[model samples]
Target chain A: MTVTVRPVTAADEAQWRARWEKYNIFYKRTVPENVTANTWKRFLDDKVPSYAAVAVDDSKPDGDNIIGFVTFLPHMFTGSIEDQVYLGDLYVDDEARNGGAGRKLIEYVYDWARQHDIYSVYWHTQHFNHRAQLLYTKVADKTDFVQYGKMIKK
Target chain B: MTVTVRPVTAADEAQWRARWEKYNIFYKRTVPENVTANTWKRFLDDKVPSYAAVAVDDSKPDGDNIIGFVTFLPHMFTGSIEDQVYLGDLYVDDEARNGGAGRKLIEYVYDWARQHDIYSVYWHTQHFNHRAQLLYTKVADKTDFVQYGKMIKK
Candidate 1:
C-alpha cells in the first residue's frame, strides 16, 4: 500500500471527513457536523492563517484519498522573541497505523516550520495516548506543563 | 504602610498603568504603551469578555491607588465540559512587598473563581520567578508543566 502525505485542499474534504469521523469515534466524542464543516472550511481558507496537512493513498487512483490529517495555528508569546505553531489536531486511520504516514505528516509540519523559520511546534494529549506519545517524543521535548482552569459566573 | 487590593475600575487606569510599568520593569522589558492601553481597555470594555482585579493602598486619599493587578479570560476546554478561567497576568508593586497585597489579589481571584463554580484556576509563570511561584504554591498544585516554543520566520 503506497501512501502519500500532502497539504490539504478543498478537493479532499469528503475523504478527510470520513477519516475524521473514525478518529472522533476512537475518542468517543461526536463533533457536530456544522463545526466539522467550519473546521474544514478554515483549512482551505488562507485568510484565516491556519493550515492542515493530510496523508493519502494514491494507489486507489481516487485522486489520493486522505487517511490522516493535522492542523495548526500560528501565535506569538507575550514576552518571547519568537513565534510558535500550535498543533490543534493530528489523526491517522487505524489501517494506516505504523505505515509512516503519521510520521510523514509530522515531518512535513516540521519542514514547513523550519522553512518558515518557526521556532517550535507544540501540542497536548492525554497521558494514555501512548501511540501519539511515541511519535511525539521523537520530535519534541515533553514539558512538565499541566493545564488548570476555573469557571466564570455569567 | 498599609496596602489594599480591590477590583479594578475605569477610574484606576492611571495608577494601574504606573504599577504595570513597574511590573514590566521587574522583568527587564518594556511593554509598549499601546499594548498596555489596549489591555486596560479590554478589562473595562463591557463588550469584551475579560476580567481584572487590582491592589491598591488607600493611605493617600487623593491619587493613592492601584499598586498591582491581575487579568484573566474565560474559556472552555475542548475535552472538559466545565468553563475555565485562564489567568493572563499578575503583578504587585515591589515597594508593597510583605504587605500581603499580592496574596490578597490572588485570594480575590480564587473567591471569584469559586463563586462562578469553576473547578480550578490556572496560570503560567516563568521558571525562575520564585517569588510568584511561592505565592502560587499556596493556592494551586504546582504541576511539572513546562512551556516549549519554536520561533516562526517572519
Candidate 2:
C-alpha cells in the first residue's frame, strides 16, 4: 500500500484522537481530556508552534485514510540561529507497522523542518522500544545523550 | 560561599556570555555570533518565553558575583495541561564547580516553573558528563530515554 503524509486538519479529529489515545495507552499514560483538547486545537492554530501530521494509505477510504500520526514543534536552540524541532509523538496503527508509515511520517517532519530553516529535528525514546529504534537508527543518528527530569508531584 | 539565584539583568551580560561561551566550549561547539546575540536579547525580553538566571556569590564584589547561569523555557506538553520547561543551557564557572552553584541554579528554575504551574523541568546531558550527573542524581530522576536526531547540513 502506498502511504502519503500531510498536515492534520479539523476533519481528522476523531481518528486522530482514537490513535492518540491508543498511543498514550501504549506508553501507560492517562492524559487528561483538556490536554488532548488543547493539543488538537493547537494543531489547527497558526499562532501556536505545535503541529501534527498524519500518514495515510492512498488505497484506503477517506474516513479511514490515517494510519499514523506525528506531533512536532520548533523551539529556540542556543547552539544554532535557526530553531530546532522536537518530534514529540509518533505512532502508527498496530496492524500497519513495518509498512513504511513510521518512516514516512518522520521524513515528513524532516521536510517541514528544513523548509522552515530548522537545522535539527530531535526526539527521545525509551530504551526498550527496540522496534521503533530499528526504524529510527535507519533514518537518524542516535546520540549519546540521556534525559533527566524533576517531576512535580501534584 | 553563599550562592543565590536571581533573574539575569542587562548588567550581567559580560559575565553571562563568558560562562555561556565556556559552556559551549566544554561541549566542543562553536555557536555563531548571531545566535549568541539573539539568545541574550531573548532572555531579557519579557515577550519571549526564553529566560536565564544567574547564580551569584553574595560575598563577592559586584562584577564578580556571578558564578553560573541556567537558561530555560516553558513549552506545551502533549501529556499534560500545564506547560513543561526545558532546562537548556547550564554551566558554572570552572573555579566555582562543587560549590553548589549548579544545584542552586536548577532549584531556581524549579521554583519559577512551580510558580508558573509547570509540572515538569527536564534536560539532557552527554553520556560522559558524569560530573554534572553527580549533582543531577541528587536533584532529579534520570530516565531510561536516549536521544536521536537528524541534523540538516546547510
Candidate 3:
C-alpha cells in the first residue's frame, strides 16, 4: 500500500487518539484524557512549538484514514551547536508496521528540520524495545547516553 | 554561605558561560561558543518559552558569585496530560556541590512550574552519575525510560 504523511489537523483528532491509546498500551502507560486533550490543544496553539503529523494510506479499506502519528518539538539540547528537533513520540498502527509508514513519518520530521535549518532530530525508547530499535537503527544512529527524569507532580 | 536562585539576565553571560563550559566538560562534550551565544539569546527572547535561572552566592570571593545555573522550558511530552517543564540544563560548580544548591535549583523550577500551573519537570542524566542520582532520588522518583537519539546533521 502507499502511505502519505502530512501535518496533523483538527480533523485527525479521533484517529490520532486511537493510535496514541494503542501506543500507550504498548508501553503499559495510561495517559489520562485531560492531558491528551491539552496536548491536542497545544499542537494547534501558535505559541507552543509542539507539533504532530500523521501517516495515511489511501489503498486501505478505511481510505485516507490516519494510521500513525509522530509528535515533535524543537528544543535546546547539548549535542549540537544549533538547536535540534526531538521526536517526542512516534507510533504506527500495529498492522501498518514495516510498511514504510514509520520511516516516512520520521523523514517528515527531517524535512521540517531541514526546512528550518535545524540539523539534529532525536528521541528515546527503552533498551529492551528491540522491535523499535530495529526500525530506529535503520532511520537514525543510536547514542550511548542514558536517560533519567524526576516526576515533580507526584 | 547564603545563596539565592534568580532568573538569569544579560549581565550573567560571563558567569553563565564559564560554568556552562565546565558543565559540558563534565559530560565529556564540547559545545561551540556560538551555540552558547544562541542559547543565551533564546533565554532572553520574549517569544520563546525557554528560561534560565542562576544561583548566586554572596559569601564567595566575588561577593556575589554566580555558582551555577538551570535552564528550563515547558514542552509537550508523552508521560503527562498537561505541559511539563523540561529542565534541559542544570549545573553546579564543583566546589559548591552538596550545599543544597542543586536542590534549591530544582525547587526553583518547581516554583516556576507551580506559578505557571505546569504539572511536571524532568531532565536526563547519566546512569553512572550516582552522586547526582543520590540527590535526585531524594527529590523525585526515577523513571525507567532509556534515551535514544541520532545526530541527523552529521
Q: Write the per-residue lDDT of candidate 2 for residues A43-109, one digit (tens) a residue.
A: 9999988999999999999988899999999988777778889999999999999999999999999
By the DockQ metric, which is better: model 1 or model 2? 2
Task: Order the candidates by lDDT, highest first.
Answer: 2, 3, 1
lDDT by residue (B107-145, candidate 3, tens digit) is 999889888777677778877788888888888767766
Lowest lDDT block of 10, candidate 1 chain B: B145-154
Best model number under lDDT: 2
The TM-score-based order of candidates, best leading, equals 2, 3, 1
B-chain TM-score for every candidate: 0.86, 0.97, 0.93
Task: Mark the 10 consecutive residues where model 3 chain B has the least summed lDDT.
Answer: B144-153
RMSD of each: 6.0, 1.2, 2.8
Off by over 4 Å in 1: A1-3, A150-154, B1-154
Docking level of model 2 = medium
Interface RMSD of 1: 5.8
Could you say which candidate leads in DockQ? 2
Q: Each prediction's Cα lDDT score?
A: 0.69, 0.92, 0.82
Using Cα atoms, each model's DockQ against the true complex is 0.23, 0.78, 0.48
Pairs that collide in candidate 3 are A35-B81
TM-score of 2: 0.97
